[model samples]
Target: MCWEAGLSTEAGNSVDPRSNGLFGVYVHWPFCAAKCPYCDFNSHVHRGPFDEAGFVAAYAAELVHFAQKVPGRTVQSIFFGGGTPSLMDPRSVGAILEAIGRHWTIDARVEITLEANPTSVEADRFRGYRAAGVNRVSLGVQSLREGPLAELGRRHTVDEAVAAVRLAQSIFPRTSFDLIYARPRQTLDDWQDELTEALWMAQGHLSLYQLTIEMGTRYYDLFRAGKLQMPGEDLSADFYELTQELTQNAGLPAYEISNHARPGQESRHNLIYWRYGEYVGVGPGAHGRLLINNQRHATAAEKLPFDWQRKVLARGHGMVTDDVLTWEEEGDEMLVMGLRLREGIDPRRFQRISGRAISERQIAELKAIGFLETLPNGFLRVTDKGWPVLDAVVADLAA
Candidate 1:
């Protein structure tokens, strides 16, 4: 059961596996000031005073748990994501980081990103986060318009978000912000104006996501009740096209489906995910994939915040599911995650990992329809034309 260096070995021997050479840590801070209507993330609002110290301790313990499983590895990236990572006290962040450092080798140039809500309150902690070793900060701006901000259940005003972004730019070495588009009654002109303003304000990275109505979210109920009028498919396609055009012109092209970034400014933490690299997810409701003894194992933690903490305190880890994936499952996941990137996936690498070759006939069919193309270096990627029907293209290829 040697996980030293996380080197890959043959199946069931447990002699460490991570030969692809990238590893990361995802820390989910499952607490938010308020949950948005369109949000389906594992976030909750705990009224009144809560035991923050208990949670921090639990996080540290969980890090230790993962560290044992993947010991002697160099962590390339660490991401602090929702409910609102910015809500954590700087000391809590430092404690978790310290725990990671104590158990594993940290990369000299590791990218540490913290996802923050662009509120005046959280913006004040930007300096503290930086001082505590956070180099990148992604603000959840959601929108640039006053109306959309309110409609999205965002507590921060447009002005506040802007100010926070400015402050973050001044404080953090790297800064990225998010904006949701194709909202109810939103027109192309409206989006053009807002995205233009965002582009003007953007320094390096922007996460422009289309509004998706997930099954359990409030927006889903509204949509089913005929109260929410989302943009039609044609309009949605226009939004995507315009997004690519504007961001490309700004030198911040879409690196992934929803994320646009200037060259070298992409979120390395996210890249680890899209590249299908090894990583451990700590905190409530976080999902992770690791190359354990050459088998890709998917892990998920308990969804409830306090319940996760209780499990961690009692058993040293809150993980509730750790399923070893079959070769076919691994292959499908690799394609599913890797194809989201503009750089695409390498068929040879996929074959090496999955014991299956990507179908040449399927590739030909997709290419004939202009949905797939082979890179000069032989990487298979989805094209701009294909991106619109990416799900269908992937399904056909996977099938």
Candidate 2:
């Protein structure tokens, strides 16, 4: 029940944190102005007055707590993810970043990013965030159409979203926004026109996600009641194929399954994750993959905001789970995460982690079926044809 409990490093003490590879930090801000019908992220709408100053202190303490566990690692990226991190005061963000710098040797070119929802008021805070040392912003501009925007429970209008994007572009050195496709009754042509406009507004990166009805969300309830109709499987596949073709032609290729970006503009923070890099997750419902003593450990924090804050203040950290991962888990994780990237997984690293060779028989089956391709450098990647059924590919390989 004590999420902030620490793992003893008695066996891990001989391991060098730096040698463990890419390090990043993830900070979760659990408060949001409203919860969308489709979102399953650990975000809540708190009606009472939020204690920004207290939360800032708790975040700083949590950072120090993790710093002690894994010392001497240079942080290459920091991501402030939601429940709508934009809800936080700019000063709160600054305090947390300052705490990180004090704990670790921050890479000179460290990519600091914050996730924001496009609203006029949040737009006004873009400058404050940049001044707070955030160099990048990812906007939640889910749609450019008013109907879909409302259906998605977004408070911002099309014009407001555009204005926010423009404001972000002007204030930050790097910016990206998200779009959701394959919505209920979203026609191919409707998406095409919208995507075109989105590309025009995009700077160099875009997070394009297919709408999925997650269990326990309002969407799921509506879907079960037959009120929400999703795109059919075949239609969704067509949408995926069209998205790849269009984004590739536009010169912002699909760097990851759902994220498209111009070369060199990929989200470094997200890359740290897909590349199986180590990162510390702070705040409620945050999850982390870290090197404790040389073993890769999986960590997750308490999910509720007040509970996490209270635990951190009392116990110095908010980690609920800190289990060391088995080689098989690491290998499977690498395959699932890395194959999401266009560059694919490094077989040598997989072997090193899993302590076994990939089944040549499985590879041959996938290759023969035209679902996978082997790079000249020996990495195994999913072909464009393989992306639609990526889950199957990863499962077959990881099996």
Candidate 3:
């Protein structure tokens, strides 16, 4: 199909589609040295040695399996995310990249990112990762304060986190770090001070997240038992406002709800997800969206590390759930994901995919309530007031 930049002929038609559509790969590493109390992600801590070479082989096989299904699609980005991707040996990383190169055509400017924790031991391997085709690194520096770091069950100290950032900046072409704010006993002034320091240390991007006590996490138990207190709604709103103001002034604006980056420096891998582009996720507990036979399919792999590996070894892939989404499902997902970005969703594109347009009355009502705005580019985005209640806003529009 002949096409212009940033406009797809149909949903899920192109491989490596840039602005209009994109194809990427997400590799999940589900093992960690220790699991954090608040983390609900599929990660495991093993006391004894495990088979690294065997795992790498399984990954290569899985790649070949997905490649057969998604043939001829050029890869635009490759992300190594996990329980700490930095824990993998550089040689393992190199082998995985080699397998990917063999399976599909990779863009010359493809953004390859590896998620790392900021321990000195991990930082020492930064050079090796850069050499093994990781051009970008996102460090999990949850806090810059010792007390909070400990409370978050992070192993690294503040100094180690800073050093790791500096080291990553020196080794990788791009670097981004995460910080969790709105913790118990956290004052606005406290966050301001921490964010100021973080901005000073930041090179290209920052991900600032509010602490949410999710179900099944340790924090959930604490909150239910009256042992933990979070910031009230009003104070949380203040914190959000402060964050936006600080980041905007610092030249790193909120590109997404929890992510801030300089113009032209946004995470391309994540943009694929938010834009509802096609991607294949490999490894335990990984979820993916891909178009097969002109239908969008949602896929998820087994959550247990060993079981996933065994399944992949026996069969070609470890996918446990593969469901074709309905049109309504597509519309709801497009709104839920795209509205998180500052660029917002294209209404015409949504109409094309969903076979329906957003209600003008609802749009006008949302704008009147100060919860939504019409962008100059003709895209509709949630306003500052809307972001805090993003779920409700998206639900109303989806309804």
How much does each candidate deviate from the true structure in C-alpha RMSD?
4.5, 5.4, 4.6
Q: What tens-digit string does per-residue lDDT give for candidate 1 at 1-399?
A: 111233223222123443467788999999888889999999998888888888898989998888777766778888999899888898788778777777767776778899888773454577678777888989999999998899999999988998999999998889999999999989999999999999999999999999999999999999999999988999999999999999999999999999999999999999988888888999999888877666778999999999999999999999999999988888888898899999999898888777889989999999998999999999999999999888998788787
- Using Cα atoms with residue i matched to residue i, what is each candidate's TM-score against the true structure? 0.95, 0.95, 0.95
Count clashing residue pairs per candidate: 3, 2, 2
The Cα local distance difference test for each model comes to: 0.87, 0.88, 0.88
Prediction 1 global C-alpha lDDT: 0.87
Model 3: how far is 86 from its true place, Å? 0.5
Taking the tens digit of each residue's C-alpha lDDT, what string does model 2 give over 46-161? 99877789988998999998999888777788999989899888889888988887877777677889999876346557778887888899999999999999999999999999
TM-score of 1: 0.95
> What TM-score should be assigned to candidate 2?
0.95
Q: Whole-model lDDT, candidate 3? A: 0.88
Once fitted onto the true fold, the runs of candidate 1 whose alpha carbons sit more than 4 angstroms away are 1-18, 120-124
